[model samples]
Target: MALPPRPTPNLGWSLEEPRNEGNSLSVVERRMLERGKKEHSETTLATTRALQIAEQCQEMASSTLIEVQRQGHALDKVEHGLDAVEQDVKEAGRLIKFMRRWCCFQILCCCDCFDPDASMDKSRQRRVRMRAQEEAAMAEGQREFHLAQQAAVLRMANKGTDSAYNGNDAKARSELFAANIRRKTSSREGEALPGLGYGLPDDDQHELQRETQLQDANIDRIGTTVENLRLMSLDLQGELESQAPQVDRLGDRTHVVHDNLTVLAKSARRV
Candidate 1:
């Protein structure tokens, strides 16, 4: 019973152990940790948004690159087609030129079966004939001119001869008249003149010499005129001969050219 009363007394004065304050977090520290976790969650959301925008830009760039490639291919095809068409046009032009040249060559060579007189167009044939005639006329005119010149030379010589003959005839007449007067005087005076002898009168001798010279000159002029006329005739003949062949050849060539031109025109029309 005494022990129990002692224990009750100690209960009121209870000896409790010493309490130590250790290094431990408080309510304020716990609040700071919660705020930091909220900030981290916001930063993560922002990073996710930035990554999404970058991916969208990359997709657009890829699509644009593909479209550019397609456009480039189309342009290349167009250029190639143009090049091929140009080459075809060039070949066509070359063929046309070749055909034209061939036709010209045929014309120049006078291809067969084409009659200048019948097959050729009338106007062209007429022109060719007219050209030939003109050449002939020119040759004739040249011959006539030469002949006229020769005739003029002959006329000049003849005129000179005639003048000489007339002069000589007058001198002869004077001499005869003087001799007759002297004879009559000698007979009337019943005396002969000393100088009066049986000789030709000076006028008669001069007349005879002049007549001979005039005759010779006239003969020479006639011979020269004849020779010149002969030469002129030869020249005219030669000209005719030379020009005739040329005219014929030119006519044939012209006909051939007309035929070839006709054929070429038809060909061009077809093309």
Candidate 2:
């Protein structure tokens, strides 16, 4: 075989096949490969760890936001509820206050209706009225007695007195004049003037005049009673009217107080 190509130097010759230059690794190359492999592994591990940490952080943040939102919503609900409650409370208070005012006004009205001062006036008036009545009765009796005296005097004058006696007539006339003067005085003092104008013996008519004076006195007393009663009743009515509005105002104030209290309560609840 023509020397078999002079024995190809057996470059691949050792029995285990010479380590190929291409296949054999140098120490530096091996070290470089190992370093590269180690770096790659570290980079992958770092990437994975970083991704996991980022995911964990995102989850924590999301949970935190959810909690915050939930709390905010709860707070909003509470605030809204409080506002409504406050309004209700305020309204209730206002109503109660109004009711209180009404009650006070009613009480004041009652007081005005039955004022004790008015009662006092009434009691005094009653006593005065009684006195007036008694005086009127006394005057009436006096008048009746005087009328009887006058009739008797007239009849006696007609039967017993001797005419033709100027002196006797004059004495009788003087006496009659004195009696007439007394009658006039009684009439001026509001006594009932007897029917003095009726034609009758002057001597007999004095008693009649006196009776008329008594009637006049009774009339005067009745007039006074009427006037006084009228004035007193009018004054009582005026006073009652004047005080009535005060009672109503007090009731209104009480109602206002209740309304204010209700509003304050509601405000507090809202807070």
Candidate 3:
């Protein structure tokens, strides 16, 4: 006899249930994958922007360095001009000294006279002493002026050195900033997905870094050369100030010597 007919399997319900479940699972997975892709794209864009910013900073730094160098050159020219002024001053001093000595010598020789009386002898000796004293005073004034000039020079030199050190520090900081940017870019590229071409090749990157380091070294050597020039100008100004007193003293001494010599001449003529 035929077995009782098996209840018709609920194949439709079973197949429909499984299909619905699979579709739901697939939709969730697709959404998750899309979200991941979007995040990755955003990350890549951000990295690119960062690279651009880094490059801009590098350009700015380069321009700053150039400006600093230009300033340094200008300072050098100023220093040269000051040097010329100093030479002129020195020449003037020599000429003045020569003229004074020559005039004094002539006056002394003209006033010289042989005197047999004791009073005349004493007067002649006094004239000689006064001449010696005048010469010594002139020499002392010259020495004082020289010393003042030297001191001023030393102070200016120190100031220039300090300014140079400050410039070097600024240059070093810029170089370091650039180096850090390069390092970060390299690391970011390494972390990025393959084939994204997010950063420079290893060789190019290394070359860039090397070039940056070289620039850094060059900048360090640059120091604030202009600072030295400024210092030189200050030194010259101080030198002039110091000379003023010496000049006044020399003038007063010359006047006193002239008066004494005039009196001696009258005495010799009378005798």
User: On residues 195-217, what C-alpha lDDT tens digit does candidate 3 reach at each position?
Assistant: 43225345434544444444433
46-77 per-residue lDDT for model 1 (tens digits): 54555455444434433443343334334434
Off by over 4 Å in 1: 1-24, 99-270
* Every candidate's lDDT: 0.44, 0.46, 0.45
Q: In candidate 3, what residue range of length 10 has the lowest lDDT sum? A: 158-167
TM-score of 3: 0.32
Output the number of the lDDT-best candidate: 2
> Candidate 3 has which clashing residue pairs, if any?
none
Q: lDDT score, residue 124, model 3?
A: 52
What's the TM-score of each model vs. the native?
0.30, 0.30, 0.32
TM-score attained by model 2: 0.30
Q: How many backbone clashes does candidate 2 have?
A: 13
Best by TM-score: 3
Candidate achieving higher lDDT, 1 or 2 = 2
